[model samples]
Target: MSESETTSLEAVDIVRILELLPHRYPFLLVDRIRDIDSDRSCIGIKNVTFNEPQFTGHFPTRPIFPGVLLLEGMAQTAGAICVLASLAKSKKPEQVYFMTIDKAKFRKPVIPGDTVEFHMTKLNQRRNMWWYRGEAKVDGAVVAEAELAAMLVLE
Candidate 1:
């Protein structure tokens, strides 16, 4: 609602994103959130660094960002949107569970020092289930995308 948030490029620190998502340390794919619109949409940013564990064996010497990891980043970014829309303060991320992924594609290889941005938008909802479509990019070039589905599980 504020001018900075309305501008659509605000940055979210890792701690803030961790508060909404269950991922952490080595497994947390997203580095920060740049923007979020509750349930409507979310943009997450990740800075790939040479220190990542995957770089060791993903190639041993010439590391190419794995396509599945890119897809995972996109899904996690979308998951952050879902959490903000439905579970910002529930104490955990399993309250909403991912169910399916469809129509996924990879267009480029993401490498170290690249900052990837994942943009996700809500497509629809069915009862406790939510559907989203997303794209991941680096330097405005699409690196990955998918039609994803998730279910909000309650305790």
Candidate 2:
């Protein structure tokens, strides 16, 4: 929909994230956003499960959520903020896309049944480009964090 139409508590679903982000299954990370303060901040969620593609190679019997993927989820969450921030700046949220990642750090292993919460906040938005800071937490403990960049296109 529109940036003005989105909100917190019940934010974007996987389908909505797919519509807003340039990612998909086997790659798409965030399952949903618990909160989205359009252009400001948002919290994304991912329920780690053994069925995920990464589990196939990330230790077959004992699967753990890949750290990079965790950062990716945070980036995607950051992307959502970037998307909304760009829309606020350019007036069209649909054109935004994630472009870069920086300062990514992973603290612990995330395994099956764990619910990762990705919290992202917009650091800046200059025209089509947006920058954000993100963090991933489980059980209220910091699991990962990063700084990410994204752009908005007219397509």
Candidate 3:
């Protein structure tokens, strides 16, 4: 889609997020999307809770959200941006697959009741591949950060 066309969108709710991405319960980390700047950047929300399945096994007593999941959430946000842009241009949804993750760092331990905000920015796009940089924050404090690469498969 043209820059202006996709940039017209300001936010995407759970319903739209469900339609744009394939992830479902237990795996779908993004609850809502806001501050979308077309395919350039976006913010994704994930509400962490004690009842989450991962917490049951990841740490029965300590219960810290997994770092890898944080990266996955950020990647999902980037994928949402790509899907939204593609839908705007072709009216067809595509699947985004993780290609690589680099320089991932965990800055803090995310526990239950913490709401994570995933901020993702597109660094570049070449053909079907997209490069992104993302950070996961809890209450304005960064918990994780990473550089991601993904491939968009046209369906």
RMSD values for the candidates in order, in angstroms, are 3.6, 2.5, 1.4
lDDT of 2 by residue, 45-153 (tens): 9888888778898989888888888877877777765665555445555555658888888898899889999888878877677788888999999988889887777
lDDT of each: 0.78, 0.77, 0.90
Better structure of 2 and 3 per lDDT: 3
lDDT by residue (19-73, candidate 3, tens digit) is 8889999899999999999988999999999999998898997999999999999
Candidate 1 residues lying further than 4 Å off, grouped into runs, are 1-11, 88-94
TM-score of 2: 0.85
lDDT of 3: 0.90
Indicate the TM-score of model 3: 0.94
On TM-score, the leading prediction is 3
RMSD of candidate 1 to true structure, Å: 3.6
Local error of candidate 3 at residue 66 (angstroms): 0.4
Error of 2 at 110 (Å): 0.7
Total clashes in model 2, counting residue pairs 3 or more apart in sequence or in different chains: 0
Residue-by-residue lDDT tens digits, candidate 1, 37-89? 66677788889998999999998778888888887887777776666555444
Better of 1 and 3 by lDDT: 3
